[model samples]
Target: MPFFVPVGRRLSAALGLCLALLCLPAFAIDAAPADADPAPIALDARRATISLDGRSQQLLDPTGALGIDDIAAGPPGLNWRLRGAGERTVLSGQTALWLRFDVLMRDTQAHWELELARSGTDAITMYYRDAQGQWRVQRAGDRLAVSDWANPDRYPVFSLDVRPDETVRYWVRVEHARVPFSGVFQLHDHNTLREQRIHQQFVLGAYFGMALLLTVVALANMAVFRDAAFATYAIYISLLGLSMAASLGVGGQFLWPNLVRWNQEAEFVLLPLMGLVGLMFVRQVAQPRRIGRTLDRLCLALAAAWLIGIVWDQSLPSALSLQALSALGTLSMLTIAAMLGLAWRSGETWIRWFAVSMVPVLLASTLPVLRNFNLLSSNFLSQYGIVIAASIEAPLLFYALLMRSRIQHETQARAHALERTEPLTGLTHRPHFLLRLHDSLVRAQRYGHHSALLLVHLHNHAEIAARHGREVADRALVIAASQLRAVARDVDTAARLDDDSFALLIEGPVKPDQVLHTATSLLANGLRLSPRLPAGTTLRLRVVAALLPDADSELAQDAAAHLEWMRQGMLTLSEEPRKAILRLNF
Candidate 1:
């Protein structure tokens, strides 16, 4: 859709050239016969001969044949035929000089032909549009239109055979590329009673299911990752797939019976919404900085617009706005692609790979967009692209998660190695106090039954270390551990929680006051902290404690609940940690 402006630009240029030619002076275009012989020349609009040439023995139009102009809004009967070339002339010539008189109008339609005289023999290899909206060749007699015969927009070719004096009524049928509704190929003839209905049901059910499932999965991942890119893209792709499928007629058949009116509006509305959401997704995924803020604004604005439109659901302008939204979304994609060029130049390999993933997704989805817009022919692939794209996209999400985990692991490794631990004192250095405390709480749950965390902050620790030197500081820490070990029950756990703060996990029924008193006594005076404690100094200690109600399997979960209490005071405890305790019935 973003690409369409250029197409329109080219169309404008072409229209200018056409008007120039149509209004200019009359002249004869040299007619080159297929066999190097000569053929009659038709009227040229520039020559001002609007009259038909009666010399070519023309074949009448088929009774049901609608001229290309009749379908489009210009010259109603401009789509006509030239007949009466001999069977030899039709078949023996290596190639025929066919003139395709394409009528450009709303979307557009085209018709033209070569005079082939004889009954059909070799297959007529003519290009047709598949449901996916790409141009492809089909056998003349092939059973077509499961996908509306979407021929690529190009010059026309006609092959026909006529018997001697026998009239051949070859039809040149053209329609605007089938506009996909809800991922379904448009239908031209639906008069069949049972057959069309059955096929309609099966196709609609299948595509709708695929689209719905895609939507759910995309939304689910968005919820999990909270990745704006993922959420935006998933919504876009799912809705695009859904809108495309519904537009195609096959999907909508289930919701609405074989009726003309109901299908039109639904297709119109979904097309733009899909484009809006999808473009937002691209901006996030691609991280095109230039487009990011703009896209973000567009998404917000479009969302509001859609809400308004939904309120006025009865309007066709709302439906047309979808096309505009789609164009806006396409702009986002182009912006991303441009940024990828920078991502490559910067040598960001991961971003580069991610950019690669988006290319295929865009190309695949584009076929359907082009089909829906009547810009390209039709095909059966409207829903298939989403399935393929989602498969590719799912892996990218996992890769992102893996990259995050790898980064986290490396950070933790560095922290573990760099942690400052006192080898002699077995006390954590100040630098590692927080990390050790966190790790201690994490590992202590195995035996922390009815556990109480006791934080003993020794007063005058620096003075003693300075007076006795490192030797006395070492001895004091060793002695402190030993004294605590002697008093601590076998069920209790102890750690020199910090350089000057030892932590005790008292089990069973120990009182907080008892722990505090013992901490003060063990840190006795003459604990000569640097001989600077004014000679006969006693150690003062402060204590903090946290009590747990039970030991539990989900101690981590419980720990999370108690984190706030731990942060608030010198001495803290919580009952939350015990809530996750598991009891064996045996």
Candidate 2:
């Protein structure tokens, strides 16, 4: 306290001490061991292949202004980080990435190729020094036409030439603007690479062939059944197959090799379009209105949003577009998941099959999106996951469609049957009976085939109803219906035309004698006693048979007029005798 220094001098001393403390660590770090250069990967007769991903170092060019010279000069503080074990090099944001690795050749005769195990990069440039000590550049990617690539292939490939016992350092510049790029770097001999490509192509061809077969089946169903569900499924599968082709680089390599711009943009456009169509297919098949109006509207709204996303993706920058598409894809999957839950809760049993089929595809489809978003590393699962999953999903989905179609067909059949048949007797009602008669008459006229219509009248139906009750009268009508059905053959049509009149159309190849025999059988059956009727009550029937479509008859062509002729014949027979059979030509 007694030896106080000046205030300015005290502050200066404390600042000097703080500066020295900060400088001390910097000096110590500089004096510490420097990081050694990574050893060159050796490729010899015993080991002709190696994975460059583990041996490489990566540098990010934020502004994308760095050139080969700048990278070669080893600028200070531009630290190149080593790739960790099993780590994939991922290109993200708006930045370009540079990868450096060295390969030592032991066998001079072997031709080598470096392969980037992915196909959707925007541009990839490989830089190396040749024997003459000049920098050589080779380019390949979706941005460049496949025909113009240094090596036209499903993946970016580069030829490597080096002398025996020489170590060649390589610099790979990867720029993917629209999406994140993550891939494995492999050095394979030329023959081995070709074999790999052939195997890959075979597997992909099998998958696409299966997809095409399923799509053809769907289209055939659409045409035959005229169902919107089948049509929507066909479109969805087609777009999904095309999108897979584009993502796998098969489209660029074989489909449209010269369309560089379209090749670059195809994946982005097709993926969302697939989602849109897939939603439509789901809605058409699910018929969510059976569950609730809210679910139906949700499906429509989701489809519209996906459609909007397809257009919006084109307007955004490459990175932003990828991000947006990835987000939308996630939302789409979530929407499907939610629909599955709602369907389950609402007891949509058919949707259970749909939900089960979606599991593998959903899991497989998510890997690529995660890889695109840099949330997952590139691997076999991320690259070919959809292909494997689609192979399983396609067949399952086709089966689901078949089940749904069968259920719908059965439902429609039941509804139609209810509309056309009489409720009490389960026989063709009056309107449908006339329609069948008209069809039969037209066929008989066209083919010159003989056919007959028999009109049978219950003579005492009103007398029984007045004596017993309406129930007893209904029982008599039912018993009468059973007799007519028993008398009719498989090719014949039976109908309850009115309160007491029944009609039977015996289909073609019949003569008047056969018609007379049929009429006598009906009269005999009508006189039989039935336990279902009142005690001591026997049915009395007046029968009239009309042979159809007579060449000289004016009313032969008209089914209604011919049926009226049969009725008049029945009325005439009623006045003449009891239990009499009357046969007429019409």
Candidate 3:
């Protein structure tokens, strides 16, 4: 001011002052500062196990071009973000992902293992340094046969050794290009890891055992009853059990350990197959056509779609196939629900209970579908939900099948009764009587025993019907049937041979005299007055008896010809004045 500065100079002085003030904080900061490293995870006496979800750092390789050396170099461009707040690590659309973490051990010596808890990853490689300062690598995942993995197990496992106060660095690379990747990583000591694996296997064993038991029961029922529903149920459960095994990695680890391609493709194929068989089972049990023709056709179409989906899945990409199958599964569940609902509304009351039984399995099945679509993360429920629910569903479904079988048996028994018995007399009809007679005569011939056939003709049947109404004549026939049943032994067969004729087959071990006595009893009983008949009415009978298995006459060995011979004897006796009993020994 005292030097009389110009206006522009004054403004420039102010700007210089402002620039120095902004530069003061930058001058205070140190250049070449050390990189920020997160604190190492401690595995001490109190912390024997830990999950790496929130503690580990992850780097995504979009093109999967990075190698172990590039990851190990910690390039400035590689940004690793902490895997925070979630139990599962999920990365979509990336060809590979790298996980890095450091573990600090305070124990004297510790044997630890790192487990990637998901089973279906394409490939996984672990990079670390041994105590000898030499780089080491371990390989595991579905691309390689389970038998060839660094550790052959249901899940990929890597071993680690740390001394007291030693800090070890680890790098894990995951390659999952076919589908979205989701995994859980956990660090555990040797004993804890072993115990957990044993528990898991034990639980899986229980589930598979239950599935086997159910399948056996279904097959047994199918064999005994010859029900298509039971057979279909057995197939459905078997496929379902195998599908779950593949999904849980048990198939890869134990069933087809050396079949790397099949192990990867098994779940994709088995799920559709299981669904198809399940739909067929529903059709057998529900018989949806009973509800509506449209509903039935829809169910058939859905099942056919599942069959086609099996073929479609094989030709499509893995991710696309999974998505398609998930959609199909969801549609199948809905279709089943609709079919059951329509059936229930149409008065299939028993189907209500079946629908109730289906709820748990349908819900459980949806969990895996959700997982396949990446809508749900992998967990115990997602992994084993179907098995647990199937344990409940299997028993209930068996009960439903039993109910259905019983109903069918009862209906068939009623139909058979109607077909074999005379409706008016409630006695064996002509066809069934002939069948029994043929059997009895064959047995008598085989054992050289005596069997007798007694034939009675109601001589006054026409006269009585003419006098009274047909109703009174029916009462007389009923009386005759009751008398026949009362005189016949339990082992003997009482049958109505024709409109006015009745017959009693005395089974083997009978003397001729006994046959004569039986004929006499029948004549005497028919002669008695029945209160149910019209007043002053007596049943006059012409009785004929033939001992079966005549050695000389072939007619005696044949049921029809033997009965005709007895009828001829009755016709000959018709000419007699008196109602008489005729016994013929051939």
Highest-TM-score candidate: 2
Better of 1 and 2 by lDDT: 2
* Tens-digit lDDT track of model 1 for 396-496: 64355345335456777656744564565544444455443445455555545344555555555777788867666556566666555666667665556
lDDT of prediction 3: 0.79
Relative to the unseen true structure, what is the C-alpha lDDT of residue 451 in candidate 3, on a scale of 0 to 100? 87
Model 1, which residues run further than 4 Å from truth?
A: 1-214, 217-234, 284-330, 339-354, 368-376, 379-387, 394-499, 504-586
Model 3 poorest ten-residue lDDT run? 25-34
- Name the Cα RMSD for model 3: 17.1
User: Positional deviation of 427 in candidate 1, in angstroms?
Assistant: 13
- Quick one: best lDDT, which candidate? 2
lDDT, ranked from best to worst: 2, 3, 1
**What TM-score would each prediction reach against the true structure?**
0.39, 0.77, 0.76
> How close to the true structure is residue 244 of candidate 1, measured as C-alpha lDDT?
50
Residue range 1-586, candidate 2, lDDT tens digits: 8596543244335434543443342233211222655799887767656787558887788878899999988989786877543453445565788889888898777899899888888989999999998999999998899999999999999988767899999999989765555678899988788888899999999998988988899999988767778888888889989999998999999999999999999988887898777766766665668767877887787777776777777776556766777777766666565565555555556667776676667656666566666556566876788888888888788887788888888888877898988978888888989989999998998999889999988989999999999999988899889899998999899999999999999999888888888888877887888778777898888888877887668886678898788888887887887447876763
Candidate 2 or 1, higher TM-score: 2
The lowest-lDDT stretch of 10 consecutive residues in candidate 1 is 181-190
What candidate 3 gets wrong by more than 4 Å, as runs, is 1-38, 45-48, 85-94, 107-110, 216-224, 303-312, 346-350, 409-427, 438-449, 454-491, 499-501, 511-586
What is candidate 3's lDDT per residue for 255-342, written digit by digit as tens? 9999989987887788788877877777777777875687678778887777777777787656676677778887777666666555
